[model samples]
Target chain A: MVAIADSVPKPVARFRFILDRRNVLGSIMIAPAILYVLLLVGVPFLMAVYYSLSAYTIYDPSWSFVGLANFEDVVQDPVFQQTLYNTFIFTFGSQMLGLILGKFGALVLLRPFPGRKFVRALVILPWAVPIALATVAWQWMFDSLYSVINWTLIALGVVTRSQAPNWLGTPHLAMLSVIVVNAWRFFPFAIVIFLAGITAVPQDVLDAATVDGAGFWRRNYQIIMPMILPIVAIGLVFGIVFTFTDLSIVFLMTMGGPVGATSVLGFAGFQTGIVSGDVSHGAAISLFMLPVLFIVVVAMLRFIRRREV
Target chain B: MGSGGNKNNRSVTRRSFLKASGAIGGAAGLAPVLSAPFVSRAVADNKSLSIVQWSHFVPAYDTWFDKFAKDWGDKNKIAVTVDHVPVQDVPARAAAEVSAQSGHDLFGFNGSGGAHLYRKFFINLADLVKETEKKFGQVTTIGKQLGYNADDGSWSAFPDFYINFPGMYQKSLWDGIGMKPDTWDNLRIGGAKLKAKGKPVGISLGHSNDPSTTWRGLLWSYGGAIQDAAGKKVVLDSKEAIEAAKFVAALYKEAMTPEVLSWNDSSNNQYLASGVASYIVNPISAYRTIQQSNKKLADDIFVIEPPKGPAKQIMGAASEFYGIWKFAKNKEAALEFLKYYRDHWPEAFKASEGYNNPCFANLVPKPMPILANDPTSTPPTKMAILQDSDKWSAIPGYPGPATPATDEIYYAFILNDMMTKTATGQSSAEDSVKMATQRCEAIFRKWARRT
Candidate 1:
């Protein structure tokens, strides 16, 4: 018996034959993704670069080519320097705190216990809920006049009403507050990464380590950590990238204040580009993040590729 | 062979029928898409207007304004749409609209109008201004400066209303302290006493409009400004500016809490309504809010002129204006709508509960009936102080037009940060002034080249 497809039209058969080609099929499959990235990411990125090299502003969309003048100007700015410094501190502080919390959280969840699934679901809430809503809720908690933290502290006689700490007001405290909120938002993601890496370690390997007289600490730090380093490193790359470029928490919580204590490159870019309407300088400020993030991604990806098991 | 032939014929018929149906269905599906441009053009060419503005702090104002817009649309046989965004999001929203080069026909500037900043995207409103002036007389000084370009002699926006920033104080708190905040000295002294008693004055020191306006008032009151009257130079590093910074630092240290450093535009309003605040610099919306939420506190709240400083007693006013975008599709309708809206200024003011002060001198004349005898107010005349507020009011970049330079500085919160730095002991008054001056010089120089 002949195949039913044999009766198909010559054009349809020819088109199916072309679709069946491996390279063509592969290309067609990824066409949407490539188009998505090109349109959304590539176009905007190129536009930003173009804007950075020009004297474009919302008031005057002249697009006059200025040739690095904006970068030179922002580089010389004392505030921009402060912003750069704050960005590093914010990113490092949040990433470190997140990874540490995530490691411990994963270890806790790893042990079999009652209501483990429920507890795991709760851990995912911070990462799952909408960030804007969460940030607004945090804003109220850190409010100057009605901070719940201050209320509790005062109630506990830890501090008087007059002396209660202003979390989002004082420069140091504001920085610390933003870092804490960012870490809280990012830790759940880290926890999942850690859980995956830990579970991927074979039981036989653990059993062999145990037989070799390796203790919990020894296995965790010396054996398991090195084994999981590649995955954790990948997670760290994402965490750093997200935390470093974050604008929402800072914007909604402190607005880069009390005197730009919590100002980061992303927030500064938005303030300059959007609020101040200096598009060229804003583009420059935002583009400054690229090199740092690029380096991180390259290093982690290289490490991941080398450690692929 | 005959049966096989019949099966093949039936199969071909079904396929042909499917192709015919698909062609018909495809046309049906694409009909709306293909005709959309013509439909939109027909609507856009006539009888349509759209507006975007900050959602008023007073809820009743938005309700009344939307209804007013719909009524006007109905009367004119036009389709009108209104969009409201949070006050804090207005600048970003405007920036987005300008970037896209397409948005509502008329855009409302709620605070210090950005007519000068985004002037290129806005239509020249000089003719509208002249027409309004012919009927209602000259616009108020601050109103004109807020939306007019001195160089081109063009009005970039039509001045609508100004919100008077008064000294909203807790009557009982001041009475208990045996003082009133009539002057800067008295404000500091009384505020300190109140602070010692656990009731501190609340004014924003953060990057929001409240701080932007309030700090400018303080700066001007000390004989300092961001620019000279020519609006050509940065004059923020003056001795008087240093003094203003020093005075504010002292005030912050002695009279206010550190929390004020994180306050937004609405924070002070919330602070005043909380009953723990002795004083706050805000519009009548604060009092209006408490009237609905806390009547007892509302009764204790009263408005007064902003504290008189050593040099002058000008108050920083938050003005509202409307600009027609250059890319607007319904220019004629928008202009007509604005004229109609202007004719109903008194009604708009009433809808705002007297919060909206007319920019036209004759639009809502002196001793405004609603303000002088507000039935909703506790004493029925408590809001009378705002009747003559325009006399003491100054827009952003006072002593000069609101130029691109001042727009940059105001939105950047440069002055607010300078004050905050000194007040928080992060920088000395001189250093803060110097730093802020550097920032302002950069901005002024940039705008100088462009303008």
Candidate 2:
């Protein structure tokens, strides 16, 4: 009787009796989520693949199959090449900086302090503020002529008005400025995650390290880090994906300028596809993200699973 | 008997309303494809028009336009709605409307770029333009260059107004240096001296509309043309074009601040209004803004025609276009409204505080008291030099028409990229011009085939 009930279709089988099989109940519970993913991620991703194989314009309805040509055009263009280089640099630079800074902030906040709650909120403010508004403010702060940073530097005699650096004008500096903004925005979330991971370490484990005379760095790198390797991996995965695909900072601040030195994959795709109206080429540029991000996610997941094992 | 209450009456009223709506929808669906706007309005029984326009930089202009539109609607018994969005987001919103096949009957673009790109989606206004032109004196030649499409012999959009892209300078700054900001060379040289004093020129080199307008003036003045007069060939690789690039590189290094590489449409205005910039290439709006905040600076500031390059006295202008969408729901009303607006534009010009320069000959150099002496300027002759800008200025595609090809160049900001590349020394002037020529040719070829 039970076997017969299990073999029945889910909707029909559900009312016949209370679901006994864990697998069946779980599948039924997750069906809506599976459908959501299929409709949202799977559909758009498939559409992107199709678009990358065609020549499409945003203003026109007609398109033709020119298989792999869009990909070739994207890969061969010098500006696009620079954008690819910039994407990796930005993602890696921001991720490493964010991780280090976040870890430091979390450790400090973990200790007892005055107004810790308010301090925690302050640490999270960069992440909490709307990115568009934040980036616009940053754009002004980095302005070549009116930058407060330049004013401060001038006051300190570190730089003169004529010698002041144009934060978003020089190519390398523009890339660095974008990465700095991205890192600052991203580190708050990292801080929260690290805080949770640090708190999760068993009292005994920390005590063991303490009794063993481990320094703060030693404890963080050796005992605490190993114990929270899985959590760190998760944080890194989210940070990498967010940093890799970030468009707002570069778009609002530099607009991928200084000869596209600050152009990341996301901004380049937007400029080429949306602004320029070459939708297919933009899809191709966007699709490059898939393979790179997929590998990152998979590798991090695998590393976490290995740690668990 | 008493239970026969208001519920039944409400239900009956709703049924009647739905039936009327259904009939209207049915008729509208079957109307001539080109007359979608008219058919929809006809079945609705009430004359209502909707419009979308930029939240104008000069906020007072919005105040005037909205009040005037509402008053007109009241007199004509037509309900009118005007929606405003930030200027930069206009194209996306318009594109969304086109995709949805439903939106305001009329939309405005500050430049002809988006209008030309979405040519297939705009109503042909040739008849309307001709009538308006006949009534008002003919639109300035720049207006014809922007709105008239030779491909279909139709006005893809109606030209309404133009803004002169001239140099606005601080008189005291120039005086202190024993010079005047008259020519491009003078600007570069005098500007360098001022930069040493911590005030630099603020012409944009970013991917924004200003650079497209400002640099074209520079490019044209240097005998450089992005394309030949035919609009069919790429002519951006000439020595003239390279000279333009080389000159800009020197200016970028010596006179202009590097912050211009990241400027948005509003940045230069801020730079100038804050007293950090000695001169900028902009319309009179910036000076007007400064006047309200800093009458002292406003008194010190003066306007001049765009400095001459090596070639001639060709200034750049951004011609605003009024495009009624083909899918608009109130086409007849919208067109009528445009005719009224065009004939009544002098009033708008006054309301814009002399910022709205009319596209017709007679409408301009108007005896409007505001022009003779704007309350916003110290000298009162603040607008005098700008009166005859039509005599010297050209739109984006000067040598050529402002075709979809040129529109692409403007929208993608290929000219800005070329300038940025040359200015930043990422590529030599010759290499940058070559690159720009190649890119421009690709765009022109793509659109040419379609046309």
Candidate 3:
């Protein structure tokens, strides 16, 4: 039967003989992407994971298999614990502030008001400015001796002549200052997202709710909020991730100082790995965030999925 | 025949697909590899030197390599180029370059990071010095001292410049208050007057890597140090350390702005430039920075040897020693460049506009141009002030010692955190010092064991 089929030009044989242009085009299209992901993402990620398990100090080229030693050291470190606490505080504080301010700003700007375009552009100014420049500007504004805020407070009799507030000196205040800076810098992103979400709300449903004697608070809380929950969740996730992982602001602003008061995990990792030449310890510190970040991401994804369902 | 043709077509299509995929893969991977050879060739062909050095050093020396380049290149048919990088990023950049085994031909570093970490990356300059000295009639004593070694001449550092932290005060401010801050105690009294005049005496209690230097100076002046003569163990928790801490705490309480804790690395310059602080312990770099920003403070600002403490000893931090990379492709050229930098001290000093202090004892015999007592250059009293620098100035680890671990602890933990705790009233000086000492001991032991 095989010999007979080979001899005969059957319809199936004819179809198989023709080139599948779709398959060729599909392979050609995906070739670059496959190569990109493997080279860029897969290779580096594998290296990072491999390095994470090894004692890879930049000072020394000789790396030994330390197993989970780096992780154990990180867990045992008091500085790591402090860093975790600071990271959480920074992430949560900045995200919450960003959410509130961003939503409010979005709502106010959503309506057709005078100078709305100008105000919208101004709102984005903080986000648009380079992080280093913005942090430097904030550092100057919060200067201990000659801060504009201190001068204003003193002039207004809010603070006494001798009671100048050290905005970035004390630990608590330094943390607060960094959180404020992060919130100010990133809130514009939230605003833009929230604004898009708000605009996407159905006008008919809102009108119906208003006709049913729903007040602004009721309409916003019950109607508009549920509709925009997914967007808000996305904004929150991004805010948390960005804040938790950020080092530049803390580095430039305070360097996690005034006694490690504002030392976040990201900054700690950088300080240990790069600054102090303790790559193993730095890697350990950086990986400490994995579990917490995993928990955050998982929780957010579940919420979004549930909302979608 | 038809079946054979069909089989051949399928095989060709598969081969073509594989070839296409392979081409894409090769293109993606080949860029960095292809560029590597070119980079290597460029590095080999280039006779020009690029250095990431301290900002202050650039002004101190005239990089008149154009003449040398023309002469040397004409003689040897090789060209030379030089560029400077900001000092702060030098260590990290050098580390990256060294790890990659690429980048700058030379990098300048300070004593702490330069000696501790950068040493591992740098080539031993002992032979280079010996060879250069054989030709140049014995290299400068400072260079030899910086590169000295008893264990088969394994030293790597090449001494470039040195500066001491003198108590830079507004002389007019002190004289106007009828208060002389000759001693550490006197600073408290002077600080009180300054505070009364609504200007708190500025001192850098700021959390910074430099804080270790400040703390060490205070500790040394109080007869305390991170280690003793033997350099066997940590001594940060001693009575003198406690006393120094208490003194600093009191000073902070009375004289310093609350903002000192948050001040950036440049805060010392800011304090003096704004005329808010009456005194600060800074290098001549601070003086230069302030003069550049506000020239009015040039004469009003005075440099005094660090005030005497309970121990009656004045102490200050020394700047970093410049070293050549061990794996530097142009090691000979780098050494030659350093030799040029050292030999032309007078020219370098004149070019720097008298900002850099010469490391060589002979070259700085009477204090170079701007530091001289000549009426045309600077005030006679101004030159007189630097006279005590030779006596008071000492590197953190000097007189047969290396305290890399202690220095690291001092910067990373003690100065960055402990100082703030004491100053902010969060912890007592004794408690802070005690805790810091225990921490320092652990680190020192760990490091000692490793080395």
TM-score of 3: 0.84
RMSD in Å for all candidates: 3.7, 7.1, 7.3
Best by TM-score: 1
- Give per-residue CA lDDT, model 2, range B2-67, as digits (tens): 233444444556578999999999888865776877768565547799989988777999999999
Q: How well is candidate 3 docked (DockQ)?
A: 0.31
Residue A61, candidate 1: how far off, in angstroms? 1.6
Total backbone collisions for each predicted model: 0, 0, 7
Q: Candidate 1, after superposition: displacement of residue B394 in Å?
A: 1.3
Model 1 CA lDDT for position A59: 76
- Single out the weakest 10-residue window by summed lDDT for candidate 1 chain B: B1-10
Query: lDDT winner among the candidates?
Result: 1
CA error at residue A240 for candidate 1, angstroms: 1.8
Q: Report chain B TM per candidate.
A: 0.90, 0.87, 0.79
TM-score of decoy 1? 0.93
lDDT of 2 by residue, A100-177 (tens): 899899989999989999999898899999999999888878886678988999999998877988888777888888
TM-score each candidate. 0.93, 0.88, 0.84
